[model samples]
Target: MPQDGPQPVERELPTDEARDLLGLVRELVQREIRPVAAEEEASCTFPRETFRLLSHSGLLGLPYAEEHGGGGQPYEVYLQVLEELAAARLTVGLGTSVHSLSCHGLAHFGSKEQRTERLPDMLGGGLLGAYCLSEPASGSDAASLRTRAVRDGEDWVLTGTKAWITHGGVADFYTVLARTGEDGPRGITAFLVPADAEGLSAAPPERKMGLNGSPTAQVHFDQVRVPDARRLGEEGQGLTVALSSLDAGRLGIAACAVGLAQAALGEALVYTAQREQFGRPLADFQGLRFTLADMGTQIEAGRALYLAAARRRDAAKPFSRQAAMAKLFCTDAAMRVTTDAVQLLGGYGYTADFPVERYLREAKVLQIVEGTNQIQRMVIARHLAGPESRS
Candidate 1:
């Protein structure tokens, strides 16, 4: 079963391959993702071309092997890509990250035959994926999700609703978590359902505070039929699948938090350098300088935390606590940094004339999604308590 506790791992700097990946990621962010980010966010546009570009760049499958048309990169490299992409555009970065998470169950748990059949399309194809686990009443308490999948001969009949789903309506496929037994965590199981399934439908996008460019909605499954082969692992393993996927997904959110924080810091730095007050630049003010310093420090710490978690994950070590720590620390740092960035920008930061406001908005969601910060703290506390807490 998926532990509600945090992942524990060590912190270390990136290696040569990680540095090289960051370089490539920086180039891609500068050349492709950055320029149109604001416009896309304003219009809530899903960049189909951008996804194609990323796929062509071998980013869509960064953590997978090349035999499946992937980049054959490590989690560290893949996360650097995510960080740069998020720094450029939170929407696109998040979409890509979530797509990667959606693929986790199938990639790590699927049989070789299943991987052969579906991975290529997922890794190289234009279609994106959505992970369906959180229902209206089951946000942080995912084990209580009411969605159900019942055996129907050779297929399974799934019925329930998943709420606050990123790419809910737009995804080509969904990795759904549904109950298959009496109740609780072990009763659940994971399944891959096509978007075109007969009884699957998505509600109109939710009106959200940020990430407007990425559609968030509720997906309804009314007798949606999926083949037995679509099951990700053995029966009664849905919570485990969900938690395993979340360990990876938490890292994605951490990367996003750092990226958002970096963008805010970058904007604040530019504005402080250029905008003059009292015959001097804002950088001359010790108050503003200290704020910038704090932001930078927090961001660096967050980055360090995330990198450590990534390395532990890549090493196949126990990293659940580390992942939770990264998610919590980075997201909280983003909220602080972005808020400070706005303060550094003065009134301009509050307006649409600048991107700081947008970063602040984007930062807010980072705390709420992928298990809220409250949940993260709970996980961390549990991990800190050790095995005795399990008793």
Candidate 2:
């Protein structure tokens, strides 16, 4: 049989408050998230209520400024909270990360008036958000996005479709990137668009392999008119804003990946210990024990790597290279650890009765999202070797 629940992960927190915050997160996970996770995911039910609860409890905006209705936690502390949430259910964890990503441009680059007007409501109010940069033809090549924003009097008319958006239809707001001048990245600008904009719409959510409880859809902006006041950052700095947000968002994904792998390892350890084979527990065997050790090692290494990158971010240092490395290594580690877990569970692991199978499917997507593992490698390589020559 599977264990009662995932075991607690030991953490080195910076303060007593962070430790207490982790305890509360774990409590919420056990009491609410983990119990209903499998059932809700099976039914593709979005946990809007759980998100509302997180907002009320001040979890939705942990790494932002306290004056903006955020928790004022450092990235190091904030990411561990994400890890705990992900261990219970990835939908909630990744949803929170995406919401934070959506808020990045407004919080960091918007005018003081804009932050004063919008940040508090977005951070802690009962509102959800989506980031809109990926498009049908522009996933990795985000700079090539064709979403156009034409100036119209004091308004901008946006017309494009954003593909693979996390909270596509359900978000209260979207942070959109659109081309306003030249054909390349320099001409793009960011906008904070309300979901109720006149010409905004969303297609049905995609049928995904896992994380069914988190809706992913394509959002359409059919000449939607946004006031100039809603524009974020300067008229031609969208890529800068988007890339900055992604560096932090990658750390979020890395933490979530480590949490997922840790959960899988916990399940494997419990299942193997209880399962018998030839008058001995499966865990007593050397090969399976070695596998379990490797899984645990990978999870720990991934956790440490992401924490290091997060610390760099907290100190206001250049961490783009570290962020890419963490995203690459942690997500790849998650895939390996989860797969090993499924093997350890034998035939039972393949069945829906065991969460290892769901974990395996979920791990696959992490390697693809937030810039694919390939893109991560490319980013890391650029940091090492400089940008590739165009000639």
Model number with the top lDDT: 2
Tell me, what's the RMSD of every candidate?
Answer: 6.1, 0.8
Model 2 weakest 10-residue run by lDDT: 1-10
Candidate 2 ranges with C-alpha deviation above 4 Å = none
Checking candidate 2 for backbone clashes, the offending pairs are none
Question: Which digits, one per residue and each the tens of the lDDT, describe model 1 over residues 263-306?
Answer: 88888888888899999999999999999999989988999899
Off by over 4 Å in 1: 1-20, 387-391
Clashes of each: 8, 0
- Pick out the ten consecutive residues of candidate 1 with the lowest summed lDDT: 1-10
Provide the lDDT at 199 for model 1. 94
- Mind giving the per-residue lDDT tens digits that candidate 2 earns over 207-264? 9999999999999999899999999999999999999999999999999999999999
